[model samples]
Target: MAPARKEKPIHSLFAGATAGAIEAFITYPTEFVKTRSQFGGKKEGPITIIRDTLRTKGVAGLYSGCMALVVGNSLKAGVRFVTYDSLKHKLADKEGKVTPARSLIAGLGAGMMEAIFAVTPSETIKTKLIDDSKRPNPQYRGLIHGTASIVRREGISGIYRGLFPVMMRQGANSAVRFTTYATLKQFVQGTMRPGQQLPTAVTFGIGGIAGLVTVYTTMPLDVIKTRMQSLEARSQYRNSFHCAYRIFTEEGILRFWTGTTPRLARLVMSGGIVFTIYEAMIKAIGGREDEQ
Candidate 1:
């Protein structure tokens, strides 16, 4: 078998942005519901949450913060896939095969960079917008104003309220996701005929499984991140550790899995869509390093 080669970083970045935007557009409502369910102590079923949101805030509520999310996702996924591809390419052995360990390292690095640069601020604004929907007097008017408000009130740090948990979550999320998807594809396509592409169904299935693994593995941190980002001025929990401790002691450990329903749905769909499009884009761009 011939070794795979790296594609241009610009290609990877553009591919990531396109894939992320597509996924965000199609599945953003699920994400909205996920954020709503993640906040608040009581567990509300998906139906109840949806009905409540629709009844109180109207259909538009389902798409609240979607614009911000789209922009954020574009940047986040762009940076993530680009970083992963560059790192994996650099780390590949002489045979041009990325070992599982190397793949994992690349994924971790990508996740960390994306979380720090894109996810934290985007998520803070997105979550705040969604959480504010039910308020009698909403604090934020829109994306630009909301961002300005956060900066003005809490300084630039306000936008990064959940940086630690987000980093932990994204690091684990990308590491597990990329490693699992790549490993599974490699195993499934053990020795493909030259120029043979993995079937779309197979890619989607593998991606879904990868998403499930990522969500379950990082559920606790995800919950904590939601809480931290969703906070307004209330310092309910001191830090990530304190937040976890408080959630555990007050809301029970199971609360750490809040919004699993919408999250699972969103992720499963997102993983499949994003991976499938990204792979297709890479193929279209004439890149052979398809594993990661």
Candidate 2:
């Protein structure tokens, strides 16, 4: 398979969107479980959550805010790769090599761009819908209805409630995820012949490892971001800082990892699927560095 970075930004964007759409649809149940688990206690474990959601709302309940997430994540992933490669292309040295610092810079910029443009609003709507699901009379019906209700009641700013923490989480997330994946891929390639492409399984393994590394590194930020984006956030917390403070004080430090298991499960699968599909797509496109 071709290195995804060798693809033109437009091709990467298309590959990424395709990868993200498939990944999001497949992994959305885990995401619903993760969000629901974040606000629930130990008693509401993954199995219990699934059982409850299925019992009350059926399988559709598990996909409560899926469309929003699918669209948002697809767009986010596309922009993320495009922005990362574009910036990396600019920052690469004369020999077409990018240093660790430059790689980090590119990843950070990509994550932030995706956060502002795609993640914040979609996440806010998703979180609200998931939070609403627990209620006897769920206020929002689906993505369109949920988004409309949020905007009507709270205006456009409602959709961007968790902008700061989302940016922070995404920044740290992509920075660590991309860097770790690159380093791990480079290490694997170094052990092989020059220009030898990695096996699909190996690429998936590396991506999963990178995702595992990212989850622990930024779980706290994710916790904060979830809380801030939830329906009750306006009444419960003042801002991102206050949300962090409350979680640390009232909820206890370990509570910040409340939904780690589900998130870990989702991201590990997500990283692998996204990268594997992306590389395959890029390879099929027959992309090379000069095209950029």
Candidate 3:
């Protein structure tokens, strides 16, 4: 008998990265709006914020941190997909079949890696652009230009202003998101019984629930990340921890969840889209395996 073909980690990584890049590119303006709204103020709504940002910063402003977003999101997606697959396989080997909890664990590991390596710098640049309409002296025309400007002015350290909060938020967010999705999928599959397929509406419903859960759970860390990244040199808070402490002390606990409304909305919409797309991709790829 022929040896069984093994799934390649790199293939999954590349595919996920490509998908993530596309998704990020498409939704980056919303992300820009989300970040700005998160850090800016409670007064202006999302639409108003977007309008003001475009009026002041123009078209380029909408895509202020495109490069950083693309690169960071790509790496994050690559690491997340690859790590999740590898860890799931290993866990399955030991425990027999893959389970939702196991998938969550895998996602946690992937999220930590991505947060530490990919989220910090990109977020820093993004936050700077969003918070400040004063186009830097020379004006950072694009992501590359902005990154270079940050590096030149602030040194290597500047690129990671909100590293800690990002790590904490994304780690927990990814874990819960993946776990909920996995568990929900299992629950849906179970109801259907042997050889049954879950309906599309059911899939979307489960994904939306998982997304809401993650957003609420990770709101505080997300607030801290946005605040830290938005800081200027003249600003008080020096780092993520300090920012979190200051916000808690000054603004109280509720301050940490300032943008919960928009964030929850964004998470629900984005999460549903991402999972649906991921499922579709997996099915397409897995089908080829079955045919072979």
**How high is the lDDT of residue 164 in model 1?**
93
RMSD of 1: 2.2
lDDT of each: 0.87, 0.88, 0.72
Worst 10 residues of 2 by lDDT: 1-10
Model 3 whole-model lDDT (C-alpha atoms): 0.72
Clashing pairs in 2: none
Off by over 4 Å in 1: 287-292
Candidate 2, residues 1-292: lDDT per residue as tens digits?
A: 3333455878889988889889999999999998987773343788999999999999999999999999999999999988987887788776566777888888899999999998998899889989998899987888898899999999999999989999999999899888888778877887998678899999999999988988999999998999888877888989999999988987789988877898999999999999999999889986546533
lDDT of candidate 1 over 44-94, digit per residue (tens): 778998899899889888988898899999999999999998898899877
**Every model: Cα RMSD to truth:** 2.2, 2.4, 3.7
Q: Give the TM-score of candidate 1.
A: 0.95
